[model samples]
Target: MLGLESLLFLIEVGTLIPLIKTNKIKYNVEEEGGCDDLDQGDNGWKIIHTDVFRFPPFKSLLCAVLGVGAQFLTLATAIIVMALLGMFNIHRHGAINSAAIVLYALTSCVSGYVSCSFYTQINGQRWVWNIILTSALFSAPLFLTWSVVNSVHWWSGSTQALPATTVLLLLGAWVLVGFPLTVIGGIVGKNRAGSFQAPCRTRNIARQIPPQPWYKHTFVHMAIGGFLPFSAISVELYYIFATVWGREHYTLYGILLCVFAILLSVGACISVALTYFLLSGEDYRWWWRSVLSTGSTGLFIFVYSVFYYRNRSSMSGLVQSSEFFGYSLLTALVFSLMLGSVSFWASLAFIRYIYRSLKMD
Candidate 1:
């Protein structure tokens, strides 16, 4: 993803120029005493630069979610790259499934590390609680959803329902292996955690956000933001759906690799553009907005799933419907979190770079 990392870098070269010029102009003015009351009167981005890095609301919950989301993101990417490189038996059924399950169980360390490190940086006190939340956040929801769907299959006497032994094995793996790894990672991450450093010093009192136009509203930007990222991979998305839902065989690993890169690029660039727009409009509540904006790609995906279910596929029966929609929801939610993290991290880098460019006194 080194190339993909240039997403904001590529777009910001043009967009941030105006932002840079404006700051330079302001910089020349601030050299004198005329703009001494600038902090009080300004509705520009620099005013809120301080608050931008403030620990987000629900700091513990947010950190845990981000940690788990990031772990899954890494896991997904790793599995794809490994499959692309032929490190596994991609042609065999259940090979990918088995590998993914094993890798996910092992990646609890990542979840714990990121969660505890982030929580510590935010000055959080309850490290154990935060790590526990991180480990359980995604897995708990998934298990519950799986259990419900499996029960539905069981009632219909379908073979899709997991066996009792399998269920017990899964639980045992998580409790015995995943849980301890998470605890170890949390301990290490806390011990090695760094201080939270902001690009600018936050003001004692938060400045009231200036009124924004309707067009600049979060949802409005999100719709456009989501569309761009979703469009980038719509073609590949269809193929992915076909492979998952139909009898389509996807052997184009190279194309899949390209699409993966494109997905990250689209998500990062769109997020940076949207974040820039919001910042220019003097709205600083971008923490969740950036995530929601790019994550809305999942919304577009869910809509596509509906269309696929109704018109494309002839899938019928309670078991099929339950499985299709159940897994679809999980897929969309995971996609949202994964891409949302990519977007947020890209936006964070863009903000940091822009702030660094500023001639702050």
Candidate 2:
């Protein structure tokens, strides 16, 4: 599947590169007040270049989401590298969990910087609110889930519940270290930010998006975009699930690393392809669509978890099920943000590449 996707992406790049070059030539001639004999009717993507980079609706939320996604990407990569280098025993779940917690706190600045810089570029006025949103984007929901799961465990008198001191320590770490670093990063980012550098000038009024076919709709994109990346990692995911829930110990960090890379590549490729289709259809609202298209992979992950729980795992009961699904939900959320960020950035780069060479006012 990965090979096939890569082939298709290569084919797409080959086909589009010449078209982009041709469009650039014609656009340059038009700009110089010269006429080109070639018909311009086929330049669907070119026609919407003006609105392609326009800031999407809910720009603040988009910036925050992307920022958190960046943080997750950094954390995941760092952990994988450390594990591959044998810095810690992969079987030591406690050590791994502690390292992950510390790394996540340390990476808070990444989210802050990315979110604030992006918001600033889009000319956002509420810098303070943007920073707050970025800080709380992932943590808030996570805290809520943790609270519920901990309460359930505590009520059941299970040793799995975190002690009060440990919980307080985790909270203190975030409040003192994570939040401050995020604030500092946001301040720095805001100071360094500049106006958005769009290739073409946006019109005073927004352009009307043409009616798209059913296949071009957001749901269809999400289904197709999410499925491809999910398929790429589905087999590896079974082993991961077994390691986490069953008694099996997974130590294949190398294969895990390779699968992770393939997952991201497949996601990026599918997203770029979908964004191109959206642009060709004259749908300028590709911003959120790009995210959701690949982000939907998380939904598939959660669905697979349901299947695993039903068919594979023997664990049952309210407490166990609650704990399993709660953590699974968090896992799904992480993947969604991580892959969504990759998709959006890939599409953004592709859009910029194709539009940058055109001579547009």
Candidate 3:
């Protein structure tokens, strides 16, 4: 299963690279006053000035028709093969589960690469950061699942050990099929949308006033602004470890988790809105500061993980196994990445909103 998961991940990565290169996802830009150094060229202005603002939500209708449309082709192929096999009744669960995981994983990689590439092109962020973050988000779940499987002692008492052929097939699938799929996905996304670079423009020095002091710096604002979101996230971590420490009653845990998530999301929105309101009043320094709120979650998760490890007695025996420890670390790492990703994107969107609000005048 681990090998199969790896294969799926690789395939998604393979597919993502090309997509990132080609796809031109729409990005919002602030149109500056017409170019000043106007040499009378064929097109009136010799240069164009523009500022990148928000990235619009993926044009869902178009994405549905093209991006998802292509993947459906593969889905249809899988359905056809499943129909041909008389053993469908017996093999249905394993086959469908494996296919679904691969398909979704591939889709995520493609979407991420496309989105990242588009943003990188617009903002001129280094390509390395784009690729690294995209890869981390798409492959995070796989590593988490692997950690869970490795940590559990299936052969002890009643746990059934997986057969040898299953393991081999899983390995083969990732190496042969998954890796190729990911690479191809990336390439396709990239090819469709090239990188974004903000167009340069000349500004009138006389008209421009130095941005106000409270609005001139981002650091302090960002650090303080991150608190609400981080607090909500820490509340969440408290319960997660509470459960891992042996409270298995889902009734109470489930409700609290849902509440925690909702409040966290809402808090994030409010923080952004507040920041935007402040920035709109000419506070330029507050522009990117609200985004720091999400970073608090990452800090809390790290601290909570320490407590979880120390308190969970069942995990003690597993800790003795290098395999179990490896799995535990993997699980922690992936969960942290997912949470961190959520915070980052939320903060980014908020900051973009603030940037646009400030520049609109």
Cα RMSD for candidates in order: 12.8, 12.4, 20.5
True lDDT of residue 29, candidate 1: 50
Q: How much is the lDDT of residue 306 in candidate 2?
A: 99
Against the reference, the lDDT scores of all candidates come to 0.80, 0.89, 0.43
Better of 2 and 3 by lDDT: 2
**Candidate 3 lDDT score at position 196:** 34
The true-versus-predicted C-alpha distance at residue 171 of model 2, in Å, is: 0.7
> Which digits, one per residue and each the tens of the lDDT, describe model 1 over residues 1-361?
5576698687879898999997766556543332232353356776666566656677777777667768788888888888888876545647877887888889989889988997898799999899888888878878988998999999999987899999999899899888898899999999999987555556566667778899888789779988887888888888888877888877787888788889889999999998988887667778788888898888888888888899889899889998898888888877787788788889889987776555444
Global lDDT of model 1: 0.80
After aligning candidate 3 to the native by TM-score, how far in Å is the CA of 248 from where it should be? 1.9
Name the lDDT of candidate 2: 0.89
TM-score, model 1 to reference: 0.86
Pairwise lDDT winner, candidates 1 and 2: 2
Model 1 stretches with alpha carbons more than 4 Å out: 1-42, 88-91
**Residues 257-284 of candidate 3: C-alpha lDDT, one tens digit per residue:** 4554564475457556645544444333
Clashes of each: 0, 0, 56
lDDT of 2 at 18: 100
Q: Among these predicted structures, which one has the highest TM-score?
A: 2
